[model samples]
Target: MDKKEELKRRQADIEAMGGPSRVERQHQMGKWSARERIQYLLDANTFEEIGAHVTHRGTRFGMDAVQAPADGVVTGFGRIEGRPVYIFAQDFTVLGGSLGEMHAAKIQRVQDLALKSGVPIIGLNDSGGARIQEGVDALNGYGEIFKRNTWASGVIPQITVIMGPSAGGAVYSPALTDVIIMVRHTAQMFITGPQVIQAVTGETVSAEDLGGADTHLKRSGVAHLAVDSDAEALDGVRRVLSFLPQNWMEEPPVVKSRDPLERIDETLARVVPDDANKPYDVAGIIGSILDEGDFFPLQKGYADNLVVGLGRIGGHPVGIVANQPRVLAGTLDINASDKLARFVRFADAFNIPIVTLVDTPGYLPGTSQEYGGIIRHGAKVLYAYAEATVPKVTLILRKAYGGAYLAMCSRSLGADLVLAWPTAEIAVMGPDGAANIIFRREIEGSDNPAETKAAKAEEYRQQFANPYVAAGHGYIDAVIEPEKTRGHLAQALMALYNKQDHRPKRHHGNIPV
Candidate 1:
């Protein structure tokens, strides 16, 4: 064949991707092929594939006859919103999208290039774990990829989308990534398959029940986002990338938003009910302040008590952490603590300013929480907020009592500015609790103990439970109207935009994991 014809033949063979039959099977399963997914995620004609001609080197058990196009993976650089990113998609049609020596190498190359290029890296995972035919070489491939994932952490943004089965060692890579997006009904991730579990423990469970998207999102807190279909999952990735910068050294891309910075939602003034015990939806408050009410929440189903996600204030991307009073009285628990700490750290690493909304009564009190090491877990929130050098603006919406007050990015925890509404109660503890402890003897001796206790509680609230008490001590920088929260936050974030805080020179402080 002539040289030009030979090039066309090689290109056609690679594009075939495990023949037309498997491609059709993939479509029937409601999952896009590897190339198609990359195409859908990136801009039109922007993908520059890196390793398309690479083939596997497996020679055991008649492996020499196998033709694993691109070694079951496609690696390349692409543009998401005109910003550079490196990606690798496992071609499920080729060799079950198994990660052999060459497949892992292709992924590693992209990872290295992403780190070197100072851009984000995305992994479209759809594999059946390590290739058993390749044995230790396959395992070694996973080890190398995992090491790079660790090294790249906090340096560049890493996102993983589980489009198919990720079993055994394959699940670790996604777990290590900054955010994990999974497709419902089509994707599953587990350390062990159901057959193995049945053989060992005899607890029968379907794969969907064991590690489905809902299972991970709501139960295990493994997945950050879960979607209905492959297309939605890819779109979810694009949305996440919009909030992040190219790397840790850069600021998140800002869009010129039409949402006015001075715009105030009058309903916010009445958001907090007069009865402090009554619960309200914090999402309403979050929506009222963010630009166009666009808040991209992560791990929404897992930690319902504490909301953490990305949004924009005056078109500048900001990480939002809020306490949901509707759930567990917005108390911090083990899971919520982990969720808050991880999101704060991620935001800090990517130079995204943090905006915290506080309303938590305190840490959840129970034997389950204490036994689960809530002390250790809660310390993570303190450590993360203290360690972060990014611009931190905290708004005390209602309840900010006890250590939970300090944990929610208080001025003591290095927050650059702290704002509060007149309804905010910033105190060591709730008035009722403090009153009971302080007036115990007086209440016990009074004719009507309940009335005396209530009167003393009211007195305590009048003395120290209001925002002016904290504002008097200068802990709160300003006490603005609830309706003006968006304006205050937008102005504070802009003023602190060039914020520079330095940590002590050291290797790194060990965060309480």
Candidate 2:
């Protein structure tokens, strides 16, 4: 064939592969084609695909017969909300979107581009693991992607959306990501498929039962957000990027508004319960205090016991972390610790000031928790909070006990401002637990054990457990009413907005307990 004729034949082949029949087959499976998904995800007419015309090497049998654009993984850079982001969308129709040598190279090239450009990465994962035809080359391909993921950690935001089946090694990329969004019906993530488990242990379990959104969000705490459809999942990705910067070096974009800081929500005055054990929604308090309807919560489902979100206190974007006493008695556990550690690191890396609302009895204590590596995970929270160099302000709403108090950005962590509500209990432990540990002899000697215990608990509450003791020792900066929290935090963040940390000429510290 002549040069012009050969080029025309290649063009025809590409178009035929993207013809209506093939594209419609993908649509019938309730998925968009690789190109179609990218188009929908990016700004209109803005995508400039990388490696758009690259093809497989000639040695592989039937490789030339297979027609694919960008090797079934459409990768490129695009704009969302006028900020640049890198994206990759897998085409499940092409050999189950399996990773071949060229396919892996396409993804790795885009990942390297994202890292060098310092733009956020969005991975639309819908693969059936590695390609068997390529054998070990496919495995190496996944390894390279993981290496990029490790290098990009904390440097830029990495987002993964599981739009369909993602099992085995495919799940690790999403697991390493900063945020994972999964579709309810079509998306599933698991370390091993049911067939593998059945082969090993003779246990028959469906994929949905083993790794669905319901299992991850409520049970395993893996998925950050769960949506009803692919459209909603993509929209969630856009919404999440709206709050973050193009890279960690820049500040998040500000939205203009003229809301006064001192405007108090009447609900805040009554939100805290008089009794310590009663549970009230901290998110409601957060909503009442933040700019109206601006609280964008991250990881809402994974760690319902703790709340993390981004919002403007006084026209300035800030990170808000709070405890929810309504769930699991507002106790910090292994999962909650991991959740908070991730949030603190993200905020510090991006220069967003952190605002923590502390209301926890203590870290959860049980045999199961100890075995689950709670100590190791809890240490991560402590290390993250301690190592953070950004401006931190904490508010004690009700309970702050023992190591949990220190973990929640207490005085020792260099919290710029620490405020406490009148009901705040800053203690080594709760009164009941304290009495049991410290007044055992007094209670054993007393004729009425119950009354003796109650009296001792009240004495501890009055003498050592209230916020005043911490204030006296200069641990707490001030005690304020719940109504004044918004103004206080707004003023605090504004003052410290320009604060910068200049470390000594050394590498980063070991993030230890």
Candidate 3:
């Protein structure tokens, strides 16, 4: 046979991909094959594959009888929109997308290229963990990938998409990435499976309950974005890249916006109800103020009381952190504090401006919060705000009570400008608690004790429950109309476009983890 014809025959065998039936079954399971996913994720005709003929070196345990095309992985470079991104997609059709020495080498090559090129890298994980036939070499392959993930952190953004199982040591690579996107029913990530858990710990659990997308996104905060399908997850990755820069040294990408910055939104006035006790979605407020109603919320399922996301302000990327009164009254808790601190530090690291919307009642108070080291954890938010040199603009939307106010970028925390809505109440605490402490004796001595306490509480509210109190003392820069919030923020962000922040001499301050 001719050499060229032999090459064509092998290529056709590899493209058949364990035959069409397996690929169809994979589709029936609601996920695409490795090559199909990469094709779907990258722009049309943009992909330039690096490794397609590499096969496994394993010969033990009947591995010698199999032909593992691409060693269960497809590595290449592609464009998301017009920007370059390197990707390594594992093909589950071949040996369960198992990792051997060559497969790991292929991934490492793309990662190395991404680092040298200073472009983002995306990993589409769908594997049954390491190939057992390769033994320690398989283990070493995982170790190499982990090393690359750690070394690439904060340099080139690493994004992981879980389209299928990521079990055992395989889950750690996604954990090391800056952002993780997972599909609802098809993806799972955990150290051990339910069968192993039952054998080891006598606890029986389903796979989805143990490490599913909802489990990670809502309960554990392990994954950042969870969606209904692989297509949406891929889109999520592209959207995230659109906001972030390829590297830390450069400013985040500034997309052109046609949304009118000066347009006043009266709908914001209704999002925050006149009834202080009624809860409303903070995302509505964020939507009213951001450009084109675009708010890419981080951890939407976790620590919802504190909303963190990236959005554009007058075509410039900015990080938005706000309080959601709908959950636990928007009280600062351990998870909420950690979430905000991490987001704040990330935005600061990448040179993104911070715009904070404060409406918290205060830090959550209870034996559980204190026992959970709320004091230590809550300090993280304070430390992040005080240390950040990026342009910070804060607006007290309603209530900013106690130290939580300072924790949320108060004027004293080096905020470039601190604006407050007319409805804002920047006080040490809410009126009920303040009145009970200050007028206790007077209320107790009155013939109608309940009536007297209510009167005192009302008196306290009238005295200290408005933004004018904070503005009078220069704690707030200005009190603006609710409709003018978008305009004011655009101008404030514009004025601080070239802000320069200098820090005292130090290698790096140790933040309490």
Candidate 4:
């Protein structure tokens, strides 16, 4: 055969994927084909395919008669929004997108290129776990991929999109990535299937209930963002990358500011109510301060008491960690601690400045928290804040009490500039709790104990619970009005833009997991 004719045949073979019928099956399941997803995600004609003609050497089960196109995975480099990125999309049509020796090699090659180039790597996982027919070779493939995932972590951003079943060992790869975007109804991730669980533990739960996108997003905190379709999941990936830099060595991409830096919102003054116990949506405060009210929330469905996400203040990308008083009274719990610590670490690693909005009463107190190791978990927040070398600017919105105050990036935890609002109640604890202990004798011996207790609590609040007390000791750098929050943050972030911080020389601090 002529060389040109052979080239045409090979090109047609690769593009065909598993076959027309299998591709149709993928569409019927409400998911895009592997190539289709790539085409949609990347810029027009920007993808440069690598390892396109690779094939598996599996010689078990049906023996060597099987033909696998692209070894069940499409790997290449492309431009997403004009920025270069490495991507690998598993073709579920080919042998169920199962991982084999060559399949893993293709993914590893892309991972290596991404790490070396200092560009982000994205994995579109729609696999049916390892190719069991290939035995240990398939298992070794997973191990190789995991090693690269670990090596590339923090150096370059790694994102995963779970579009279909990612059960058993398949879930770990996505877990290792920086963010996991899952498609609802079609995607699921679990260590064990319902059949196995029912057989061993007698728990008869469906796949959706066990590892659906909502379960992971709201309960397990495994999935960062869950979308209704594959297109939205891909869009979520792009949105997340917009907030982060191409690599950890560089600062996050700064864009033109849409909102005026000097813009002040009078509504912010009323966002925090006069009553301390009243709940408020902290998203209001976040939206008002960010550029054009644009905030890309991370793990929004999980650990909602603590809100952490990426946003721009004056067009400079920054990480915002705020307390949501609407949930658990903004108190730190195990899940919230994990969420806060991870987000802070990600921001610090990527050279993004940290903006923490504090309003927690304190740590959530209960036997569940204690038995669940809240001390170890809570220490993660303190460790993350203290260990971060980025420019840390903390704002005390309302209640900042006890250890939670310190954990929320206080002046003591190496915050570069600490700002507080007039309504901020920065104290050891709430005034009522403190007054009861400090003035116990007077209150018990008083003619009207209730009246005396109220008077002492009021006195305590006036004397020590407010921001001025913290400002007096130089713990707070500035106490500004709530209306001036955006202006204050914009200026503070600008001033600290070139902020330099150094840590003690060590291999690495032992962060509590």
lDDT of 2 by residue, 36-96 (tens): 6677788888887777676655346666677665566777789887778898888776667
User: The CA-based lDDT of model 1 is what?
Assistant: 0.94
lDDT of each: 0.94, 0.84, 0.91, 0.93
Q: Once superposed on the true structure, which residue ranges of model 1 sit more than 4 Å away at CA?
A: none
Error of 4 at 509 (Å): 1.8
Worst 10 residues of 2 by lDDT: 10-19
Question: Which of candidates 2 and 4 is the stronger one according to lDDT?
Answer: 4
Q: Which regions of candidate 3 deviate over 4 angstroms? A: 1-10, 504-507
Worst 10 residues of 3 by lDDT: 13-22
Residue range 1-513, candidate 3, lDDT tens digits: 999999899888777665688788889999999888888899999999887888888889998998887788889999998899999999888888888899999999998999889899999999989999999999999999999998888788899999999999999989888889999999999998999999999998999999999999999998889999988999999998888888877888888889989989888776778877888888888988899989999999899999999999888999999999999999999999989998898788778899999999999999999999999999999999998988999999998999998999999988899999888988998998899999999998999989999999999999999998889989999999989899999999999989998889997788888
lDDT of 4 by residue, 1-513 (tens): 999999889989989999999999999999999999999999899999999999988777784999898999999999988999999999999999999999999999999999999999999999999999888998999999999999988999999999999999888889999999999999999999999999999999999999999999999999999999989999998889988899988888888987999898999989998988799999999999999999999998999999999999988999999999999999999999999999999999899999999999999999999999999999999999999988899999999999999999999999999999999999999999999999999999999999999999999998987899899999999999899899999999999888778888997789999
> Would you list the clashing residue pairs of candidate 4?
none
126 Cα displacement, candidate 3 (Å): 0.3
> Which scores better on lDDT, 1 or 2?
1
RMSD (Å) of each candidate, 1 decimal:
0.8, 2.4, 2.0, 0.9
Candidate 1 vs 3: which has more TM-score = 1
Lowest lDDT sum, 10 consecutive residues, model 1, at 10-19
Cα displacement (Å) at residue 282, model 4: 0.7
Q: What TM-score does candidate 1 reach?
A: 0.99
For candidate 3, give the lDDT of residue 426: 85
